[model samples]
Target: MEQIVGSGKFTYDVNENWAHVPPGIEMKPAAVAVDSRDRVFCFNRSNEHPVLIFDSNGDFLMSWGAGMFRYPHAIRFDAQDRVWLTDEHHQQFMQFTSDGKLLRTIGEKGHRSETGVPEDDFSSQAWRQVTHGGGPFNLPTDIVVVPNGDMYMTDGYGNARVHKFSADGRHQFSWGEPGTGPGQFNLPHGIWYDRRGRLLVADRENNRVQVFDLDGNLLTIWPTELIGPAFFYVDDEDTVYIPEHNAGMFSIVTLDGERLARWGAPIHKSIHGVWGDSRRNIYVVQPGEWGRVRRIVKYTRR
Candidate 1:
């Protein structure tokens, strides 16, 4: 019998071999995104062809982005179907055409902000030293572009802030600090500008989602009972999908943060990325930090 997951109207059967990886090719997917055509793009950490493209039905279409990234983190599409990618290790974010042509690159490569954290300090307690917010990024995790072409990024790992930018790549302003307060953040891992005109930030380490206005004003909070809410993918109907890392699970929530359904696997943990197609089929990917590494899963709607 095939493994089935999810609940309520969000259930699906796992398609383990959804992507036909060519011979001698591997997909160490860090995150996933879909274009207007619902073409699946798997932004991975591999050295060769880190950007893997696939058809809606799991056929391998093409690949690109050879030797262009280190520690690929998040991949998202904007209103124009352009690609936005974040790389925490490189301490930068980049923009690309859907075909993998580099348009612009942000952040000074190899430069980390002075967030009171040491080099190579991955300790849990290290974030406590972030006395205040910083500029553009210091190991930024995820990004989002609003309808008006404004951008927001969760500068999580090495900093505790959400940096906003203009459509032309100019720094606008930033918000957040290191603490457990309403507008504060522990690790602002993921950011998404929902259709409701609210910025949903996955404040991962704090175990909550912080909703804010476009101008960085705190609106509300959703203690959606998630662990390590790494990233988000909001569907057309304003339904929210998130991959919770520590819980090894993903959740389906309404626009108001009400849980519709949630599911996880015993063999999976640290699910960092999640997206879906028009067919309602779900796609998820994983990295090696928690348990499993280099895995991309597809769950077809039933």
Candidate 2:
């Protein structure tokens, strides 16, 4: 596979491919997280089973989590190397060992029976009908960990807020509401805690990034002109890489929202997710008409 770097428009590398399609499984790859060993874990929304795993070379290693997961949207690795996943459809969060052992599960599932159900009503019929809950999470899109081991999750989409949890998956506190206010969110999709402990959230529909303190206090907003800035990552040098799902490309920006590099052509529409490995190789999830494909492209500093 050929590698491309620097800031010129490029076509999707049809040669450099890394994907794992296990038997009886469909690949609706939504998120990718690489462990310390360079092993890639891809989470899909196609089935309620164990997420898919692939080696650095994209070879199928193993699979786990059968009979578990409702609508797994995001996969993340903590400092301790533990694996965490958020199920937006069922309003639940789960923790697992790097090898896929179920460590713990958070939030409740089931249907709502009445109107005006409280946001935390885990079993209300209304809860089942809507995506955001005033409680645990109506549809958690992403998760991140602070330096202190506390976790921050974007309880976005159906619900417009972010929830904080202890390392043990215990709910600590949450912030944000359904509005355009500074503290409120429209669709808080992805989240990350920068090296400075400043919370960075991908306010997708709002076309901006919302900064906050560890306590959920609104700090400021950075406008990103890209349509649907769904997910992003902040590198060691504070370079922010945001994948624009609607635009079919990714932008490398600074903390102040300056575009550094842009890649991908219009043919690669729906670039839903992005991740970089220790080798500075950027992996993107491109879901197109046929199916979802994972492309691993290497980049270098200019």
Candidate 3:
């Protein structure tokens, strides 16, 4: 029999063979997103097929995005079912149609923000200094689109700030700096905008999730001892999914910060991202380790 995991309403039966890929097709999944039809979109690190699509039953449907991304980091679907992708290597995030057509782009391609370090400073000290000097974006991470079409993104890789942008990609305001304080963040990696319009930020290095209002004001803080929380996802009922990268597990939490259930151990290759479908089935993406390729595990809620 398959192993069961989680507790109470979140209990699930693990399905290891959820996604069957063709042999020789290597996948280094950076992020995962579900569309309106419940189709799974695996954003990977392959120049040939950067986007891999699968039905909810784990059947491979199709693939696209050849020569479209330098580095695929995160994928998100907005209210209109438009796909948003963050390419850290290109230092930009873009919106696209469900069929894989590029609709818009939001940053200078390959242009990184200045870190205020000396030209001769190539040592570790210089690297630390550059990270401390918060700028527009050193390597921006995830993005959250609001109901009104506004957007918020975390400058995570080399900075610790979140910038807000208008629907058309105009900078409205920005907030944060590198620290462990309430409003501060150290590698604010993942972000999500809940139905109530509250912003949830997975402050990875700080070991906490910070909540904020639409105006970028600090509202509350949800702390976790889990190693690295790479991303955040909330179901329709407001259940939050926190994927801990290093600890090799994820906790299902309430909006009030209560951890209701936890799952994943064998799929721990490296939990980079996660999302759920309308049927409450959870999907976890492991970018794979050593020489292995990426894989997505599905857990059907019981």
Q: List the residue pairs that clash in candidate 1.
A: none
lDDT of model 2 at residue 104? 75
- In order of TM-score, best first, we have 1, 3, 2
**True-vs-predicted CA distance for residue 253, candidate 2, Å:** 1.4
Candidate 2 achieves a global lDDT of: 0.70
lDDT of 2 by residue, 64-141 (tens): 787787666788888888888878777677889987888877777643212233545443122223333365566567
Query: Tell me, what's the RMSD of every candidate?
Result: 2.2, 4.5, 2.9
TM-score (all chains, Cα) for each model: 0.94, 0.83, 0.91
What are the per-residue Cα lDDT tens digits for candidate 1 across 1-302? 68888877788998766788898777788899888898999998788978999998888888998888878899998888999999887878899999988998888887888787786765445566677777766778998888888788899887899998898889989998898899999989999988779999998889889999999999999856778788999888888998888777788888778898888764567788888888888788853333466577888988
Candidate achieving the largest TM-score: 1
Write the residue-wise lDDT of candidate 3 on 136-225 in tens digits: 656778999888888899877766788899988898888887778889887788999987779989887777888899898999887446
RMSD of 1: 2.2
Q: What's the lDDT for candidate 1?
A: 0.84
Better of 1 and 2 by lDDT: 1
Clashes of 1: 0
Going through the candidates in the order shown, the clash numbers are 0, 10, 1
